[model samples]
Target: MSEVKNRIAVLRAEHKISQQALADAISVSRKTISTIETGRFTPSVTIALKLAIFFNVTVEEIFSLN
Candidate 1:
């Protein structure tokens, strides 16, 4: 299977939002956001959509298959 890559850290930095802050906004744990940013976890579709909506970007913009 192809690996999923993400630009979450970059986006978060650009938005000046901490991992915990983003996690709170999305109703997820900070570790969940951390793992996703570190490529240790892949978020569910619901989480992905929540993130995309919060960041004002599409899911494809945050994550991609590589």
Candidate 2:
């Protein structure tokens, strides 16, 4: 299977948001954000949608399979 990748760290940096802050906004733990950023985890559709909404971007902007 292709791996999942994300632009979360770059986007968060662009928005000047911390991991903990994004986690709080998305109702997930900071570790979840960290792992996602590091490509060590893939978020569920719900979490991905929440992150996309929080960033005011589409989920495709944050994640992809490659």
Candidate 2: TM-score?
Answer: 0.96
Model 2: ten consecutive residues of lowest lDDT:
35-44
Q: Measured by TM-score, how close is model 1 to the native structure?
A: 0.96
Clashing pairs in 2: none
**Candidate 2 local lDDT, 24-48, one digit each (tens):** 9999999999999999988999999
Cα-lDDT of candidate 2: 0.95
Give the alpha carbon lDDT tens digit for every residue of 1-66 in model 1: 899999999999999999999999999999999999988999999999999999999999999999
The superposed Cα distance between candidate 1 and the true structure at residue 58, in angstroms, equals 0.5
Q: Model 1: residues >4 Å from true position, as ranges?
A: none
TM-score of each: 0.96, 0.96
